[model samples]
Structure formats: C-alpha cells, structure tokens
Target: MSVVIPVSADWLTLREPADAAARSHSLARRAARLVHPPAVVHDLGSGTGSMMRWLAPQLPAPQTWVLHDWNADLLAHAAAEPPASVSDVDSRVGHLEHLGADDLSGASLVVTSALLDVLSADEVEAIVAACVRAGAPALFALTVAGRVDIDPVDPGDRLFEAAFNDHQRRVAHGRRLLGPDAVAVAAELFRAAGWSVRTDASPWRLGGDPALVGEWLEGWLAAAVEERPALTEWADEYARTRAAQLAAGRLRVAVHHHDLLAWPA
Candidate 1:
C-alpha cells in the first residue's frame, strides 16, 4: 500500500532544498569579491533570506539586507528574525516580474539563489539590465541552464535529467525553461555589455542522504519523462525503476551547476 506524505510549503517549492543549504554557503564566499563591505544587499526572491544568511556575515559590518519575495509568509520568515550583525532588514512583497522598476535604489549587491531558472528570457535580460542600472554586482546562483554534478558515476542520471529538462522547456508560458546553457552564456550576456563576470561550481549532492527528497525527485522526473508521447515507454521503465528505488531507500539526488558572480561593467 502506498501512503501520501505531507511536504512543507518550502520544500514543495524546491526539488533540492538541502542543496541550497549545503552548497550555497561556500558559493556565497566566492561571490563576495564582486560585492564589497558595508553593502546594501538585495536578495531578490530571497525565500526565507537563505542567501542573506549565507552572504551577510562574510562581508563587512552594518550590512543592510533586503529580502524580496511574493510570498508574505516567506518575507516575514526572513524579516522577522534577521541574522546577527545585520544593520537592518527590509522585505519586498511582490511578483518578480515587477522587480525591474521597483525601488532597489541603493543596492550594493543583487543576489538570487535558484530563482533565475523560473524566469523567461526577457525577464532575465530585464533583471540583468536592472542590476546593471542599479550599479551593484550580482552574486547569482543556480540558474537551471547551468546544472552541474560532481563525480556523478550514475549513467542513467544524465539520461533522466535530459528528459526532465526537455519537459521543463515545453512548459506553458515558456516557464521553467533553461534560459541559456553552459555558464559562459550567462557570463557573456553580462560580459557583452562589459560587466565583469566570474563563475564557480555550487553543485549539490546528496552524499548518501537518507531523506524524502528522493521521493520528490522521483515524482519530478516521472512527471517530466511521462509528458512526452515518444518517451512513453522509457517513462514507464524510468518511473518503475525510480519508484522501486524510492521504496527500498536506495535513491539519492545530485544537482550539479554553475554559479554566476556578475556586476555591471
């Protein structure tokens, strides 16, 4: 008998939350170079201010943080109790589509985590333009076009991922598509306009994790592969294999990808 497992709203929003927690910490440090001390940081789509939690302390004192998200609950979670030594906390509650002309007047760093993959191409360019106009460097992480896996020995993993990616691109309103591939494309988008760009690996791995994330991953891949008529046979096989893997607790997930450290040139 199969049982339904309740998942957290935050976890539901992400296929790999643990990866953000584990991998993004180190990625924050390297991204700090583009953004110096005494900075006013805008963690756009700052769900629970995770990036602020990762990037703030490593920089100078009196660091003001602005956490922005459409979800008021998420903004409150990030705003109500800020990290120690934070100068002040401001929360922006609105859709990311409207972020371009909003009042990010004095930002020193424009940071985002795992948020860019959900945007359209026009939105990305708009965001890049906004950050450029804001005159602050951006330490963006985990744009889906740049998924990176470290030492992934599983051959079937990439096959499954490729299928899943195809599914994401076909999503309606052009949602959840990889805006670009390879880290260089993102870098060049900024670099072409003369912004300095740097990149590093912030890929996430389970490393023998025994958690329900596997169940979520199974559902995600299953839905993606199952979407295609041509891949229907493979989808059945993949779903069966992944389901069995989940039931027996032998499943783990890996997120390999590039992190962009960008600012206006």
Candidate 2:
C-alpha cells in the first residue's frame, strides 16, 4: 500500500535534493551583474528561506534579507536562522499580494524561487509592478510553466507534461488566463512594467540521483495531470507506467526552466 501523506504547512515547505543549493548560487551569481552592492533583498513567497541560504554568500557584504510568506510556520522556519554570515535579516508573515512599494522601499533586489507558476498572470504582474516601483532589480528563478523533455525514454512523457503545463496557464487569480507559456508571459509582463528582463532555463535531471526527489516529482506532475478531465485517460496511463518505472528503480527527471532576472528600467 502506498503511504497516505498528510498535508500540512511545514511538510509542504520541505525541499528535495533536486532543489540543489548550488543552483541558487548560480542564479545569485548571474544576478550580481544586474544588482548593486550593499542591497536590501526580498524573497517573495519565501517558504523556508532556502534561496537565501543558497544566494546570500555570493552577494556583497552587509546583505539584508526580507523573507515573505503567508504561513507563520514557514516564516518561523525561515527566521530560525538568520545567517551569522548575513549582515541583517527580517521575516514578514504576510501574503505577497499585500506587498508593495512601502514594503520594499529600502530593498534593492528582489527574488523568488519555485513560486511564480503557482500564481496567475495578473498577480505576477502586480508583484512585478511593486518591485519595479520600489526600483528593485528582481530575480525569479525555478518557475515551472514550461516542461523541457529531459527524460525522453518515459513512454507517457508528452501526454503527462502536456496536461500539466496546460493546467499551469489555465487560471490566474480565480479566473482563467494564458499560462501555458508562464515564463514567457512573466518576462513580457516585466518588460511592460519597465523592467529590463533576462531569462534562462534550469532543468532538474532526476537521473543518477536519490529516490526522495523522484517521489516528489512524480506526485507533483501527477497532481497537475489529474486536474483536468480532458486529460484523465492519458493521465491514468502515464501514472501507471511512471509508477511502475519508479518502483522498478528507473529514472524520472523534471526540467524546470528558470527565468534569471528582470531588472528595473
């Protein structure tokens, strides 16, 4: 019998090995060119502060991190360790929608990790606008609107990805909006909001790795595929095949294309 995992705030915020610390360092290094030194940074939807743990070292000295999230449990976890290495740190327990220029008045750079695709275009636009208004150079990495085909060997690969990616673009703010090209939509929004944008792709290869991340990807993608009845038949097929492969110790990788940074214009 499969394990019946309980859903809760802290459990939901945990990261797998696929969420490599080094990947965030790469993002931070790329962002260094665009952001100024001695900056106050904000990580929107910052659950557990992993991005801060990853990116803070690469940035110049006297770095201040403002981690924003709606869950107090998550915020508490994030605040548990304000880096002895970092110059200063603050944690705000609140929703991202309430975040605006007033919240970011002193912030120079803003960042988000694995958070954008979960929201709609309008919400994302508003967040970008707030950052722009604050004159903060922003870096948003690990958003998953596009599914790059990393494991071509999976038989039901395209069938599952097609459905899930479709689900991503369907709704933004309780209403439907274009989300299939979520990263692209975000880049355009940033540009429209007077942000100079730079984008890139970071694919999470599941091969030659451990099993924890593989399980996470399987459930995550399967949930996305199951959301639409139009995809039910294909999703069932994909799930069975994928689960068997996973049980047999086969490969399952996920490609999460990341958009690097969109700076103030």
TM-scores for all predictions = 0.80, 0.83
Q: Would you list the clashing residue pairs of candidate 1? A: 147-256, 148-256, 148-257, 149-256
lDDT of 2 by residue, 1-265 (tens): 1111123443334453455532545556768766566768898877778777767777776788888887667778777886655777788877665667899988878988777776666667778788878888888877774664544376666666676677666644355544445567778877887677777666666665545545556665666666656666766676676666666777556676575687766
Task: Give me candidate 2's TM-score against the actual structure.
Answer: 0.83
lDDT of each: 0.65, 0.68
The model with the greatest TM-score is: 2
> For model 1, how does the per-residue alpha-carbon lDDT over 163-225 read when each residue is reduced to its tens digit?
666664554453544433534555777897798887776656653654545554655567466
Clashes of each: 4, 2
Alpha-carbon lDDT of model 1: 0.65
* Candidate 2 C-alpha error for residue 250, in Å: 2.8
